[model samples]
Target: MNKDQQPVVLGKIGASHGVNGWMKITTYTDSVTGIFDYSPWLLNERGQWREVKVLRWRQQGKGVIASLESVDSREQAQILTNCEIGVLQESMQNLPEGDFYWRDLIGCEVTNTNGYNMGKVDQILETGSNDVLMVKANVKDAFGKRERMIPLVMEQFIKNVDLLEKQILVDWDPDF
Candidate 1:
């Protein structure tokens, strides 16, 4: 898929691990090694996208180190530092029932039980207790508040998430 079509960011290339072209990776997946599930990663370099194959990889201390096929030196690995590694949306595995990826929640409109439009999800933050949804206020709800942070607690706060409709129904107080 093209760069614009790529959906999920699996990981990012961090500092070079060693002189032999291995680069430290900071993954956004559930597990550190889960990033390796998809091959032929698309690296976002500047504004262009380049495909790179993972020659080999292994888990390190809480993270992962990988060697790309063409990257065979410390200097080569350095050039890829801070580059985002992503795969096409179709490459992701299907989730089980009641589970959802963070990417799927972003940009979805959030409304209250009374059918009042609250805002659109701008980002999702992971807290010690639970996940928080940061919703950017819409024109209708832009009453001095610019954003809202709602807890993603199923049945408690989050009533329903309709990804197909690009909306999330919540049990929130718009005044709060």
Candidate 2:
């Protein structure tokens, strides 16, 4: 698929709610109802992406249940169980400067302010208090570690982030 048409995974389809093809949803959005903001969801069916229209949805207690325009039977809903939901990457809203999405941070080169090549970012960790960058180091680096978890606190540790360059500069200790 074209890069612009690629869908960004956003949620997962849980078990069928009732006999009317309504299914529970587990979303990755900051707000539960925010998932509804993006319509015509690109649902992954057996690894293939198909667009599904949202008929209606509601919040029950703490969970969300939604019905698709075409799915009107329990069997149809059952077929979608465990399927992931996605939306076009372009559909996501623009984030302000200095706020990078986790997906964009993956594979970015990391360096300390002293020009030490720490490694490339492998993933991010959300530890409630702060988000962390999990950097994977070179196999034979003279440094003592394979992975480093640097907090994403901009005011202190993070010195600069150049998304265009795919690099992150931090005020970190190389030998730590």
Candidate 3:
């Protein structure tokens, strides 16, 4: 698939591990090893996405180290440092009921029970307690404020998530 068609970023390459082209990877998934499930990662390079094959990988401490084809030297692996690793959207695994990927939630409009449009989801942040949704405040509410942080506490603050409608119904206070 094309670069524009690339799916969610699963991980990012870190510093070089050793002299054998091994590089450390920080994954965004629940499990670091989960990233390996998606083969043929797309590496963002100079504004363009290039496909890279994962020759082998292993879990190290809390992160993972991998060897990618064509990268045979420590210098070559260093070139991939901080590069985003992604897969085609279609290659992602199917989720069960009540489960949603962060990619699907972003860009969805957020509204309250009283029909107050909070904003659109700009991004999601992970906290030790729970995940928070950073909603980019709409023009109507952009009076000095840029965004609002809403906790993703299901059935409490989040009422419903309608992917088809590209909206999230919440029960948050408008004043806050």
* Residue-level lDDT tens digits of model 2 in 68-156: 98899999999999999999877888999878778888999999998999999999988989989999997776787899999999969
Candidate 2 off by > 4 Å: 1-4
Model 1 misses residue 116 by how many Å?
2.0
lDDT to native, each model? 0.89, 0.88, 0.90
Provide the TM-score for each candidate, comma-separated: 0.92, 0.90, 0.93
Off by over 4 Å in 1: 140-143
- Show the colliding residue pairs in model 3: none
- Cα lDDT tens digits for candidate 1, 82-131: 99998888788889987899989999999999998888999999897998
Distance from true location, Cα of 160 in model 1, Å:
0.5
| Model 3 C-alpha lDDT per residue in residues 123-157, reported as the tens digit of each score | 99999899999999987783445788999999999
Q: Which residue pairs of candidate 2 clash?
A: none
Clashing pairs in 1: none
Query: How much lDDT does candidate 1 score?
Result: 0.89
Reference-based TM-score, model 2: 0.90
**Best of the two (1, 2) by lDDT:** 1
Per-residue lDDT of 22 in model 1: 99
Report how far residue 105 has shifted in candidate 1, in Å: 1.2
